[model samples]
Target chain A: MDPDELEFLGEKSKIMIIPTFNKENIHLISGDLGPFRASLPSQVPLWVATLLKKQKRCKIIPPDWMNVEYLEALKEQEKQTSGFTRMPSDHYMVEAKLLLDCAPDDIPNADEVKVIIKDIWDMRMSKIRSSVTKLVKNSDFYAAVDNLTIMEINSVRPILPHALDNLFRMKHIEQPKPSQNSNVSSFLMSKRASTSFQLSNNEDY
Target chain B: MDLDDTNLEDLNDSNDSEDYVHITPAEVLELMEETWVNEKFAPEILPNKTEVVDIILEQIKSMEVNIKNLSNDDFTKNIYQLEVDKLRFMVTSYLRTRLEKIESYVVHILKEEEKRVEKGESKYLSEQEYKFAQDYSRSMDRYFNKIMNFCPNLTSDTWSSKVIEPNNNSFVFMKSKKTIEGLPIDITNADSDLVDIKSGSRVIICYSSIEELVKNGDVNLI
Candidate 1:
């Protein structure tokens, strides 16, 4: 799956926001949001919070783990550990990108927090890169990937999966067959065009 | 007065349809999401969730009606509209993914469907998709014969019999939904290697080793 698709799923997660206007409990198909009283914090879906912030109707309250001190400590612990550690949010990358992009001012020490998160992200990414290299070199049959979040897992996308697949296919060829006409379907081409168009549009956000 | 008196909760209680009497609309939405992700990541086509899609579409229509009752300037209208757009995109993407797979693997999937039908097993393709695959396969057969006519001297069973099939042996990232112990990944050795996957733990493994588990919802391809 694409990283944007992961972000789309991650946006379903709820976050706290302070609405500037009063409204009745907004009943959504997934669930109800709330009867918003001005200045009172209410938990809403991440997408909703971003939408409200974009409309200048709400102040986002950053999630607890998004703070500078917490992230710094977490970064230190991650450095100390040899294996992947659990992330505060399953889609931490998505949360950081969406929240920090729209409402940096709402988060105290936002710039510092952003830098620390990037530091942690880089640390974990390098660890993954080294592990992936080791995995492909040894041609291990399988590997446990317990604590890596979805976005981090996706970063190793086509390379890791394709390499492992090719290795397995090489080992398990059934029979030698003559070359045949295998043309790329035109249907897929058009579909891919539209999909990429949507991706580029979302990237602008 | 209608605006003040409207109660969205009432829609949840007044379910006249026996098809979805047991589960609430929210649960239906949740099931749709799970189905969408599972279908997206699985190496091959999965069983269609036609019932869930139908229910959600019905609910979307109902929601649209409710929204229409509100004035255009209502801020809540945009929120509701956003959700409807998301749901619409999800359903379209899910169905499109399946259709793409079907077209790509039409012959192989049809042959698999034949065996499943012979054994009285449930089918993976929906009724409309089956029709689509049949039509596509016929066209491919015609196209192949036309191509073979250009080279009539070839005497091999190569071009006539080859069909595109999904690589089941491909590696995929998966998260176990429950603790599944003693699962055999390899049985060639005298002391076979068994995997013990704790609930919520992720792994990168060959899809064929755990294809059945995935079908049974024990594990989800990330």
Candidate 2:
């Protein structure tokens, strides 16, 4: 599929409209939409819904996954699973966040949704952090776990590559060029200097 | 009678096959935002503006109706929603950019007026200018309040207070101009207070403290 199609799939949000004008079935590049009538809830692309909402023409309907009660239950399910639990939608978290930010009034219990999402994020991050540290300690660079979600893997990508590279360098210390080693040492020194500054500042607060 | 019929026929054809162009929210937002770049720096050079915002808003209204009857795969709908997010983001940013300009100018003026008052100057603003300033500030406040209400997460307290690890160390390379809060210092200085870092300087800063700075364009994560 084209990148446009891929991105379109990634961002769908559900919303409700109370239209003032009637329009027959309109053919769009993506698909067919509506014979719109007044006060009926129909699904539209999120962009259309948001635009309407901004104009006070429509109200957004929160998706089922956005409900605090549902999320809390899902979080419980996630907690019980040592393996990955299915999410309500592929992009529910991002979609819910966007809706909550843009049209909080349309989404019921938005503040609760935010809190629950954050709780889930924190739990996932903590798990990922521990696993990442363990991976580094074991120096199992080639190991790939099937359980990690794309988001989870991406969270560690920032530090993991560097950590693995460092491990590789340590294992093959015999043939290291002097100039390259110096360059890497200087970079490490700069990093150390910054950390020292941070350590000093920590005492003040 | 032939000419009148032809004209009537043309109108009917135009209405029957109204070619609706697909527009991404970003494109509409960018078109709306073009005027503000000049307005921020040179408000005087701005034209007697047309009410184009109303027109764009009307287009958005029509788009709402258009979306209602569509049945597409999940992907297309998501892409559409993403565009909406971008539209809202652009609108928020547009308002914020103007508000920033207004705030900085008003604050500078108010400060200058205060200094003048301290120096025993009688008048800061004339009656009309005073009224205009009051109205301007009120509108600025109103717009700001509206955005805060619309995006509750925009409030600093909502997001900023969640600092889990304050002392997590990270290196930061300064990107733009920033003044660190302290007296300038050299390495040989007996006191630690004299250090002043600038662009091209790499410093290890606590991750939590640098988070806001990185977001604000003052530093780059290294």
Candidate 3:
């Protein structure tokens, strides 16, 4: 199986739907989605549930993880524990964002849920930021982080990897003095362009 | 094996064959990673990653066979095995990371170009990015070919059609679930049969039919 598919397999979304017809079952490569009945809740992949909800064939039952109470507790646990706590799924943040954006009406206390999720997310992110800053300041070559979420890593993807690369370069090369060094670093950062046509002439690659 | 060659230059010259034949897998992996991370957006650096992977695999395989023929020197054999394992690990990690980016890039470019066109911006990729895209596409093609070579049963008409038909502006595919109207699409399952698609049922439709469905969250592109 594809790695993406494997990752997605755990990201099933619960949805309440009113089917046009009484379908027995649908066998998909991901798994079998079964015996859909009108006005009943069923578990389906996030992609499928989102589609059904959009077409008015079904309404989404916001997953348990999206509950404001649960999120608040999660945030508390995150604050108290030195280690990471479990999330409902690997792609929970992306899934939550998708559902909240598309079907806000379906989710209960949608605004509150959003705030709590954001709170937990920000708390986690701030912790990540501090650790990363420490690593940079101390010039640590390797630091093992336990249970860092995929979303957390992805959120910092644009900077962290490139920062590490720059750090690696800095370690080997002699310093060019402070002002010249700042210019070089800024030049390097600017090379990380979103598009090809925006390339600067001084880009090494 | 030469006792008289005491100079550093002579010592370095003795391992010339090992130097020529045995490129460090970590270096290859690093070069490939750089090509993926930096050169992917522009065609400035072209390290043939696909070819490098192939050469590494062949080298590892031959080394495995050679190690089997050595004397019962468990100490040396264990070290050789350890080095080979490290190389294998590096290659696996490198390929996994690169392929993930390649798959995402394929989807990204299609959607990105479409958005650019709709926004009345110049939709054409810079010659460098276009070249990089071509290289990536070719690498993907080669990767799939190698997979099919190893496991012919996995090769299906649909798989090839989906990957190779890059020029088709609109694609017909099945909807895994219901979706709304007016969003863009990613291509998938081009040659599959059209069936009566309901929620979680398959349907055959073009890209535009499901644009909104794709954007509004009714259907997946694949």
**Number of the top candidate by DockQ?**
1
Interface RMSD (Cα, Å) for model 2 = 17.0
Stretches of candidate 2 off by over 4 Å are: A1-9, A13-21, A25-28, A143-152, A168-205, B1-222
Cα interface RMSD of each candidate: 7.0, 17.0, 23.5
lDDT of 3 at B102: 38
Real contacts retained, model 1: 0.52
lDDT of 1 by residue, A1-205 (tens): 7777898889999999999999989999888888899999999999999999999999999999999889988999999999987899999999999999999999999899899999989999999999999999987768999889999988997678778876655544343323332231111122221111101111212
Candidate 1, after superposition: displacement of residue B56 in Å?
Answer: 1.8
lDDT of 3 by residue, B36-95 (tens): 322222211122345445545665676677578757743235434544565575567555
The whole-model C-alpha lDDT of candidate 3 against the native structure comes to 0.50
Cα deviation of A131, candidate 1, in Å: 0.6
Candidate 1 local lDDT, B5-63, one digit each (tens): 12223333433433334566677777788788878767678877777777677767778
State TM-scores per candidate. Answer: 0.86, 0.38, 0.41
Q: A59-165 in candidate 3: lDDT tens per residue?
A: 77777677888888888998998656666666677777878888899889999988888887888888878877886687543343435554565455446544544
Q: How good is the docking of model 2, by CAPRI class?
A: incorrect
Q: Name the best candidate (by lDDT).
A: 1
After superposition on all CA atoms, how large is the RMSD of candidate 3? 25.2
Per-residue CA lDDT of model 2 for A1-205, tens digit only, reads: 1223223334544455555446665443234467677677777766566656776666777776788889999899879876556667655555665677788997787898898988877777787677778867986433333344334444564366446545544543544444422321111212212211111112223
